[model samples]
Target: MNASTFTTRFRAAMMPTVPSPLAMLSHGKGARVWDVEGTEYLDFLGGIAVNALGHAHPVFTRAVSAQAERLAHISNYFASEPELALAERLTRLTGGDAVYFTNSGTEAIEAAVKLARRTGRPRILSLTGSFHGRTMGALSLTGKPVLQDPFRPLLPGVEQIAPTIAALEKALADDVAALVVEPIQGEAGVVDLPDGYLAAARELTSRHGALLILDEIQTGIGRTGDWFVYQAEGVLPPGAAPDAVALAKGLGGGFPIGALVGFGAAAQLLQPGQHGSTYGGNPLATAVAGAVLAEIEDAGLVANAALRGAELRAAIAGMASPLVAELSGRGLLIGVVLTRPVAKEIVAAAQERGLIVNAAAESRVRLAPPLIIGDAEVAEFTEKFAAALAAVAASTPTGATA
Candidate 1:
């Protein structure tokens, strides 16, 4: 069907949380997708940075199919080998002592919040412009009030702090149980943390006896060249780490899954019956995640992401298109800020030319292509992007800064 029909049918019944169009995905492979109209587009969005190994990856297909045949789910009342294996892998890779799986990123954040509050502290600190999730609890931590205005009186004691030392000192206190911060604020048009920000936040929270919860929902799972941006940025000390980490988006290679990892002292915070899920770590999702992680190593996808990421960013920046105001982000997660507010036009133009990109903000065009994107695709997208920017510049209102 077309965008109009899809929107008309779904928007009426669905909760209007996200302004999503009903352009149904017919199929996807590698870094591209075909809509129901059979129109193919280069998928730079990558399912909002969730398709880590790209669409329909062989490893993901095989692992999920094979696990489905053996067993689907048996709940937490019983144990599954794949689930245990996935947990061990995450703990080993992340150095977290334990993990709690959820069905999506919002749920993972909820678990982390619970872990922080389990210590009897009630306050939480989060950064401005950060997009945590739409859940009521997570929504309280999100800085954007647009998402929270309709659902007022969110969880009490949630504080939104300006990304400044002065603000942290003023707002957070010993009674604060957690400080959640995104390594790179993706939905804030791919904003990166200032140098020494995360480290100082970690220290301040520790001093106050509050847990430092790193929200890696977007920047984890090899999206930032490294497994997690915190590792590459050197935020964690030799022995110290975040009390807990929330992960999702790219963890399962498009197979839905999220994780809350509690490390060291934080591990025992969530005791039995404190938190559980029916399909969080079921065989299919864990098997897929485990397979994707293994395949990323075997196929050298992580290294490829580093190399290709650099190349892609350089190409986007080098164009020096008049409309492009700035280029930001690490690894495959890059954002191009425009001189004017024509993000909708740019996105629509790119779509018409069989390219897919996302308008993250009024003047920011974010590019989160698949990890397996080749040089040819990069070149193709760059050319189309330049043209799209030119068109936006020519037709839109005159320049104003991003």
Candidate 2:
């Protein structure tokens, strides 16, 4: 069956919340993917920033293949070498004392919230416009009222404040178990937090004895030009670090793996029976994650993400279209703000031209291209994106121009 036929049937059987299928993807290579009909498209979305090495990198393939042949699944009761090695590597990368692996981003957040609860402080603080996860516990910390209000009476004791030093200080004056913030807000249109804001969070959380949890699910693992966006010098005050971090999207490079990393005293909160995951760190997932990390390090993809991201952002902004108002975010995670509410139109036009983009909001188009994207890919995307913007402008009705 083709995409339309399967999509119709699938939607009938599955939840209605899933977006209409863009295409029945069949295979991929490098930074490109093909649908069942053999149409190729540049994968600018990168599975929503999950594919770190891009599609089908040799190293990723070899490592996953070898590990699959040996061992793929084992209960948490029996630890494997790959799982231990992966956890150790992640903790070292984040300067955390220990880690608890899970199966997805939301799971990582749940584990982190649980760790916060272990503090017995009775309250958690988050920033306005934050997007932690959709699970009940995480939904409590998510600041978007629309997403939270629908499921009212959410986990209580979760408060949200404006993402500023003054607001943070005011909130911290009260008893709190943890203060969670994303180094860069992804779902809220790739909003980058100010560096001093993060430093302030570290200082205040420390002062209040509240754990500082940086939700790096979208910005971690070289997506933001660094191993972790929090690692950017000057982003954190001297001798300061987050008490915990939630990681997932890019950690496994398309494999399903997530982690909750706890630093210093925060590491000792969880006991053996307090929390667990059945398939959280199975051998296959950890092996793939380990390979993903190795490829990122060996290929210098981190530096490449930085250089290419700057180039792409500059090129897009340089277009100077009246419809293109501005750009936000860093590295491969970018948000294009438009003068009009035509982001959905732009996304459709880009897809028609064999490019994938995301409409993060009515006027914001988000691009989280693979970290392995290069100069040629960036140039091609810029050309197509400009064309998409022009298409949207031409289709606009009179008096709708902004």
Candidate 3:
């Protein structure tokens, strides 16, 4: 079926808040996908950074099937090997001592909020342009007014500060329970927080006894050239480790999973019965996460992510198109800034050329391809991206930039 037909059917079947379905995706392999009508496209969005190992990796599929055959899920009252192993591994990776599993990124944020509140402090601080999640508690922490305005009277005591050291230091108060910041603002047009600002936040939070929470839902799981974005030396400054970290997106390698890792004293905040999820650490999901981690280690995708990410950025920069103003973000998560507010036009043009990209803002085009993307895909993407730019420039008004 065509996209229009699928959109019509989907609109009738699903809730109205969801935007129109882009396409009736039939199947995907590696870094490419096909729509229901069999039209092919290179998938740069990577399921919005959730496909860590890309589509249908053999190890991932095998692990899921094997775990399904043995067992699927049990209540939080019961313990499972996969769940335990995955939690242990994640904690080790993040320099944390404890973990709480959830079904998605938003749930992870919600759990983190509750953990922060347990400190008895009533206020939480987040950076402006932050996108934690859509749930009421997570929405309360999000800095975007458009998302929070509709959900008015959100959980109280959450305030936003700028992504700068001065703003953070000025806004911090004794009543603050935690300061949540994304190392790289993915939804806010791939904006990266200054390293010194992060360092200042750590020092100040330490002094004020407020927990530091890093939201790595988009930048984690090797998406940003590191196991976790904070793992990269110099990203968070010396002696700077967040008290709590929320993770999801690519953690399960496509299976639904998320985790909140608490370090030091914050680890003991959430005791038994304080928080839980029905499918948080289900055997199936945890098994897939374990396999995803194993695959990343064995195949050296983390290093590959670093290498390819640099190459992608350099190539785009070398294009030297006047319409291409700049590029933001690291690793597979990138944003191409246009000289004007032509991101929507560029995205449509790229789609017409069988390349999938997202318009993160009016002038920002975001690309979050799979970590496994390589030279051939990069070359093809660059060529198509240039073509998309040419298409835009040709049709744009003579006085305006594409």
Per-residue lDDT of 21-41 in model 3, one digit per residue for the tens? 677889989999999899899
Which residue pairs show collisions in model 2?
none
Best of the two (1, 2) by TM-score: 2
TM-score, per-candidate, Cα-based: 0.96, 0.97, 0.98
**lDDT for residue 142 in candidate 1, whole number 0-100:** 95
Give the C-alpha miss distance for residue 375 in model 1, angstroms. 1.2
Over 4 Å off, model 3 = 398-402
Predict model 3's lDDT versus the native. 0.89
Error of 3 at 295 (Å): 0.6
Q: Number of the top candidate by TM-score?
A: 3
User: Each model's C-alpha lDDT?
Assistant: 0.86, 0.89, 0.89
Taking the tens digit of each residue's C-alpha lDDT, what string does model 2 give over 1-402? 687787988789889877878788889998999998888899899999999888998878998899999999989899999999998888778888898999999999999999999998898999999999999999999989999998999998899999888898888954799999998889988887765899888888888889999999999998888899889879998777899999999999999999999898888899989999999999999999998998888889889889998998888878888788788887889988888888888899999999999988888899998888887899899899889888878888635643
lDDT of 1 by residue, 1-402 (tens): 787888787889899866877267889999989998898888999999999888898888899889999998888788889889999999987888999999999999999888888989878889999999989889999999887899998999888988877788787787888899998889988987787787788788888888989999988888888887777757666566888899999889899999999888988998888888988888888988999888877877777778888988888788887788777888888878778777888998888888899999988888888778888888888888877777777777674655
- Candidate 3 Cα RMSD (Å): 1.3
Could you tell me which 10 consecutive residues in candidate 3 have the lowest summed lDDT?
393-402
Compared to the true structure, candidate 1 yields what TM-score?
Answer: 0.96
